[model samples]
Target: MLIDTHSHIYTEDFSEDIADVIQRAYENEVRKIVLPNIDSSSVKKMLNLTEQYPQICYPLMGLHPTSVTEDYEDELQLVEFWLQKQKFYGIGEIGIDLYWDKTFIKEQTDAFRRQIRLAVKYDLPIVVHFRESFDEVITVLKEEMQPGLTGVFHSFSGTLEQAQQVVELGFMLGVNGVVTFKNSGMDKVIEKVDPSHIILETDSPYLTPVPFRGKRNESSYLVYVAQKVAELHQISVHELARLSSNNAERLFRI
Candidate 1:
């Protein structure tokens, strides 16, 4: 069995065929999928999907970095409200993203820090998303580092040095479809890292693996990523699946 540590299939992108998507993922041996919230507006939708697929889908509550706006404080309240009201596998789909916009850098940073504290308080792992702001994210994590605080860097496409740094921080690197891209250079970086410091994800509805590049990604495609990473690590796909799924299970307690 495999666990897709990060995915957004609850979104409207998969609305038309979500059942089929889950079926395909299960059929492909991709059993558990972690669903991270985008913002306050997404909480209901995400939770509803979890209710429907209680066995296959796990929910995470948080406001994504890109969703950090002037009114983000309100969003955080909603996140906290849900956290107190229910059981969540983790605090996630959270972190700093500078690739899309930089106008709310300060707000984004503050939100990231606050959410990290929430994760600590809740005793749950965090699913981080860092794009063009690795240094900033790492700085905050270093500041907040404490016993029992850990998570994965979702969609990690960084250097071996960076990968080592993340592992040293007690966090796993989330490898996705990007590893299969010929020029992404992720395969080379992953080659040097041990499987113990890695977990598999698809970031579905985006970053579709090769052979299906340019098409909408789904949990089923995680098999493609597993196959490629297994080849890179010189291991069988079954072993890779076991290792990555075990890492995810420990991190999210799912």
Candidate 2:
């Protein structure tokens, strides 16, 4: 079964037909989807979705980097409180993103570090979102890296050397629709990284795969991403699905 490891189906983008979207996911053989909460505002919607689809949906709790602001401490407290109240598969959609704004770079770093500590505390893997700050992300991961500290760097678009660094640190590279993009450059880097170190994701409601490019994305489209991976690895789509699904299970333990 294919797993869309990082999707925000709880977002307003899917509110109109969330059930239909999820149904399509199942129909397309996307057995499970892991929801990564963006911030405090999404916590309610995220939890609600998990409750509604306990078997097929799981939630990851963490304050996203873009949500990191001056009031980050309060946000962290909320994250910690909720995480303690229930079982979440991971600590993420967390990490640094300097592409949108650099005003909170320091704060984002602090929040990311704190959340990583929380993951360490709870023995949960993390789902990182690194954009225009791969070097900084790697530096932090180096300091925080431990045998038990594992996770995937979602939507990885880095050089092969950087991909090697992430793998060396004991993390998987979360490949998404970007690999299908003609100019992504991820195709070459993914070629170098072992399939075992790669996991598939849709990052849905965004980054739609080719043919669906510039259109709304959903978990059902994961097949296209898998197809691309299969072509790149010279393996069947079923093999790619099995490998990536196994990788997801290994990292998320779901």
Worst 10 contiguous positions by lDDT, candidate 2: 138-147
Best prediction by lDDT: 1
In order of appearance, the predictions have TM-scores of 0.99, 0.99
Instruction: Score candidate 2 by lDDT.
Output: 0.93
| Per-candidate RMSD, Å | 0.6, 0.7
Please provide, for model 2 over 1-254, each residue's C-alpha lDDT reduced to its tens digit, 9 standing for 90 to 100: 99999999999999999999999999989999999999899999999999999999999999999999999999999999999899999999899999999999999998999899999999999999899999998888888776699999999999998898889888999999999999989888887788999999999999999989999999999999999999999999999999999999989999
On the 0 to 100 scale, the lDDT of residue 50 in model 2 is 94
Model 1, runs deviating above 4 Å: none
Which pairs clash inside model 1? none
